[model samples]
Structure formats: C-alpha cells, structure tokens
Target: MDTLNSKKVTRRSFLKGAALLASIAVVPAAITSKDASAAAKATQAAMQYQDHPKGKLECSNCIQYIPGKTAKAKGTCKVVEGAISPQGYCLAYAPKA
Candidate 1:
C-alpha cells in the first residue's frame, strides 16, 4: 500500500515539473515571434528608402533620424541602416511631429 502511494506522488511531481518547463519554453518563443514580425516590418520599410530623394527633406528634420554620438560622425535613421547624413533624405522621410 505505501509503495503504491509513493509511486503515485512521484509520478504527479514529474508531470508538474514537465508542465512548468514547457510553459517556460513557450513564453520565450511567443515573445520572439512578436520581435521577428516587428523586425520584418522595419526591414520592408528600409528597402523602400534605397535612394535619398532630392529636395528640402533631410534626416535632421525627420522623425526616425538619430543624431551621431560625436559632432563629426554622421547620424542614423530608425528605418535606414548604416551611417546616415543629417542632410540626407530618403523615401522613409517623415517630418518631425
């Protein structure tokens, strides 16, 4: 009788532990899927800005622009990759609001 009860308890504990591990694994996968989707959207937007258009539009006046860490270095854009110029413009350009 005692041996049978112990085996039941051990099996229940094992199942509980497995459920906890599965939940932990699932949470990260869900979060990563959201991140991947957002990354894809940003990449698609960047692709549209391949050429900087000519006009008064520039990075300094755009919302996605990030000023350089130093005065000599070029700035960057949220939708555009690589070093970006303050005077540069692209299709993703959006006036600061």
Candidate 2:
C-alpha cells in the first residue's frame, strides 16, 4: 500500500531502536566467559573427574586437556566444566599421542 511505503522511521525512533539493540548485545559479555562452556559440557562430578592423577595418567597427558595460558595454570577439559588441574584424571581420559 502507498500508506505503508510512504511511512518513514523518525530519527528518535531509529536511535531508540539502535540503543536497545546495542544494550542487548552488551548483555552477553556481562556474563562470565566460562558460563557458556559450563552449559555445554558435563559437570566434573558427572565425569568422575578428580584433582589427582590416576596412576601415571593425568589431564596434561590426555587428549581432551585444553591447556591454560601458562603451563602451571589450571586447564579445562573438552567434556567437563570448571578449572581442571593438570594433575586431574577422569573416565574420559584418552592418552595423547
């Protein structure tokens, strides 16, 4: 219809819409970065993950260990949540080649 085609968004209305979108965009970053990871993975207990090594096996030697920024810093598991110690072990362990 001509009436619909002729309508134009006002500057105030456009800015308000943009502001709302920008605020919505910023909300996700306010959440802890690890929250998403936690949601997507299993809990440490569910995987029977432990803070100590199982025999000679350890997280640092497993295929799923995602190393931290530093060697000694805690790492994360591909299938588990929270800070995983390098010495930790889990049923999901698959020795890295």
Candidate 3:
C-alpha cells in the first residue's frame, strides 16, 4: 500500500513546526519591548502625560502597574501590550495596582 510514501510529516518535521511556534510566541514580547521603549522615549521627550494630582494612579493604585524603582516607572497596561505611562490617562484606565 506504500504507507510511508503516501503519508508525509515525519518526527523531524513536526519538531521543526513546534520549534517554530515557540519562537513565534516569543516574538511579541521582543517587539513589545522595542515599541514600548520607543513610546517611553517619545513620551519623555514630548511630555505627553498629565499628572492626576487630585485624580488617581500612583503605582500601587494603577491597573497597569508593574512597580519599578520609581513611581513613574514604565509598566504594562491592560489595553496596551507594552509599557504604559504611569501618569498617562487613557479611556481604558482602571483603578488597580
């Protein structure tokens, strides 16, 4: 019946595919870091964040808080995949640390 010839997908091929998938999963983190860094730099240069003096967001009081050495440390956001402005306010802002 030529079973081997009729069928494809060997162990090596499957492993290769699995490896490819693993690598693909890690790509987003790398990309996010790059994009986040760029965004942070731009934000710092342009000063694109407002202080909620009488509002909210104080590291331990932010939804996207990651806790850094400083209160303004860049952290991940629920809406944004990368780091978000500690003082940055968005529509998806939530009160959570």
Question: Among these predicted structures, which one has the highest TM-score?
Answer: 2
- Greater TM-score among 1 and 3 belongs to 1
Q: Which portions of model 1 miss their true places by more than 4 Å?
A: 1-4, 8-23, 30-38, 41-53
Better of 2 and 3 by TM-score: 2
Runs of candidate 3 with Cα error greater than 4 angstroms are 1-54, 57-60
| lDDT (Cα, tens digit) per residue for candidate 3, span 47-80 | 3334342256443465655655677776655444
lDDT, candidate 2, equals: 0.91
| Tens digit of per-residue lDDT, candidate 1, span 1-97 | 8887676557889999999999999999999998876564344245555335458777778898898987546877787767777777777788998
For candidate 3, give the lDDT of residue 73. Answer: 74
For residue 71, model 3's alpha carbon misses the true position, in angstroms, by 2.4
How high is the CA lDDT of each candidate model?
0.74, 0.91, 0.59
Q: lDDT tens string, model 2, 1-97? A: 9999999999999999999999999888878566875688988899999999999999999999999889888998888888999999999899998
Q: List the residue pairs that clash in candidate 3.
A: 62-96
Q: Backbone clashes per model, in order?
A: 0, 0, 1
- The predicted structure with the larger TM-score, 1 or 2, is 2
